[model samples]
Target: MKLTVVGGGSTYTPELIDGFARLRDTLPIEELVLVDPAAERLELVGGLARRIFARQGHPGRIVTTSDLDAGVEGADAVLLQLRVGGQAARQQDETWPLECGCVGQETTGAGGLAKALRTVPVVLDIAERVRRTNPNAWIIDFTNPVGIVTRALLQAGHKTVGLCNVAIGFQRKFAGLLGVSPADVHLDHVGLNHLTWETGVRLGGPEGENVLPKLLAEHGEAVADDLRLPRTIVDRLGVVPSYYLRYYYAHDEVVRELRTKPSRAAEVAEMERQLLTMYSDPALDEKPELLAQRGGAYYSEAAVDLAASLLGGGGSPYQVVNTYNKGTLPFLPDDAVIEVQAAIGSNGPSPLPVPAVDPLYAGLMANVTAYEDLALEAALRGGRDRVFRALLSHPLVGQYEYADALTDQLIAHNREHLAWA
Candidate 1:
């Protein structure tokens, strides 16, 4: 069995590839291919993969190429992890929203809309290749604006699944805070990417049940300290809403008071600089083994657990993943791709239905749907008016009429990136 990593030159390339290579024993993978136009970085990661293989004395063959045609020729699975416009364009995607007096976030609002416009075309082309070169292969898309991109791929007709590190990561965080077993924590999450909410969290085996009200009693505290939500929303909703609360709460009064405002754009830039430094510095590279233990103990364990579930032997229950909504939430349209409980397997992903959602959650669903639909239009329709409507419907953007003016500015400013209306 062969697995290919498209855009394998990305920074996250080492983590995913090294993780996959570690799975060869269980999944029985035989070949690993790295595909990217950035030859220098591709060779860097390709060499690292080879070193890891030698250390383990693994039999897997490593292949590298700048040619997409040659790289994807034969593979059982392909991982899509590319940044469409690179870091510079991604900066634009993050900053444009702040310029509009809206929350500047990467995976939602006008930023997400802009990102989708640049990303969909590339993914569609990749999907076409999967159809021609590896018809039965599954494309695991890790691109930003995942919900919007996943929808566009499905609309263009392809087999794919969008992956997010939020749900499981958040769940583990909450478990540590609540002092409970991670496996005992079961939650029902609904809404689009980066805007989801946990309707109910309970503990007990299949036929039993236990709901802990005290867990959320300090909703404000949960937002402020427990879940790290912004003070603005914790002051209002009295609870933290998972999925990018930092960006949404950046301007919140309570968040400002708590002094937990979103990290400044410059701070983000610094973080990126540090990441590059660590990658290039020989002193850091000399300690390659440390990368396996890079994150905190909790996250490192969680990553291992997830990798085991996805590729390890002995079929585990299908964990919910990012896929077309179809009917995950009763309130949203069937076409929306939402992150929910799903069963994943060698075949592909199967999303689960929520059956029902709370009223507040229904409202959240509406907000997320509006944002996702408009992003789809921006990619598929490219109309300024549609983008205007999308921004108008966003909870953060709909707060004032000024948001419309901002939307117009954003649409006109980025018109070149938009698909032909």
Candidate 2:
């Protein structure tokens, strides 16, 4: 099979390469193409990718290029991980929102809306190119603001599925805590991308017995610590919220904390510099340990699993992915993209039936889904009023005063990326 990575220059590429090398038998790739505009970073990442493949004795041929059409032509699948604007833009996304007393984050709140606007158009253009070159190819998006981006792709009629590492990361962590293999853990992971909760943790497989209560009883403190939430909150909810929920559950506190620290994008920029330096070394054959700190934990495993299943290779039948709700959650619109456990195959993901949602989670999910509708509109058809309306719809910046201020700040910080600005 052939595969193309649209942003192969990313520092995260090595982790993906490492997974492909180790899981070669699961998804036997013959040709792998790395497509990116940043030639220098692409070269560094591509060299490391080749070394990792060779070190693992995988026979796949690796290719790198700046031409998107040439890179995607006749590919079996195209993976989108591109950042429309690099870390500098992300720094602005993470900092400017804090000025409005909202949590500064890349994939939530006003910052997330900015990323959606900047990313959706570029991704659609790339998807259109992919569709023209290879209509049968599947598009797997790993980009931020995945729900909004994936919605745009689907609305444009592209064959696509959105992938995120959050579910896999939680599975691995839960398995480690339960003294079981990662594959033996299954999560009732529900909600939208980034904004999700682990409602159930089943051991052995998707049909396995629930062990979430046991886990909470024994390791609630560790779980709470990982989420940066208080243990009492976990016990009260009886469900583990993704770390992103902190921006909602403790907005003011997080805003205060964000103001005291450097932007995550800035820290990542430095880390990328160091990682690129490592990738440049000819002797480095394996993914560096520092890449773990760079984030996207277990992304390689998730990508390989999803790709394998999508290509009809024998892999996990059920996994968490972002796809149309199709009434999985009665509260959400059928077209709304949600992250949940789904059966995967050559036909793509079919979301399994979600159990009735508690009003607590349902209310928030519904609120965000509405905000997402407006955010997507702003992304597709640009205007200051559209942007302002999207910001006002967000639960994080619901007040007219904060929404007005945030809308102005978001536009000012991202004028270059916004066509209508």
Tens-place lDDT digits, model 2, residues 343-392:
99999999987889999999999999999999999999999999999999
**Which residue pairs does candidate 2 place in steric collision?**
none
Cα lDDT, all candidates: 0.64, 0.94
- Clashing residue pairs in candidate 1, if any? 231-254, 231-255, 232-255, 318-343, 319-342, 320-341, 320-342
Candidate 1 lDDT score at position 125: 86
Best by lDDT: 2
lDDT assessment of candidate 1 = 0.64
Off by over 4 Å in 1: 56-58, 177-184, 202-226, 230-240, 246-274, 280-315, 353-355, 399-404, 411-416, 419-421
Clashes of 1: 7
Worst 10 residues of 1 by lDDT: 294-303
Q: What C-alpha lDDT does candidate 2 achieve relative to the native structure?
A: 0.94
The residue-by-residue lDDT of candidate 1 on 196-238, one tens digit each, is 7665555642222534344566344653674555455555553
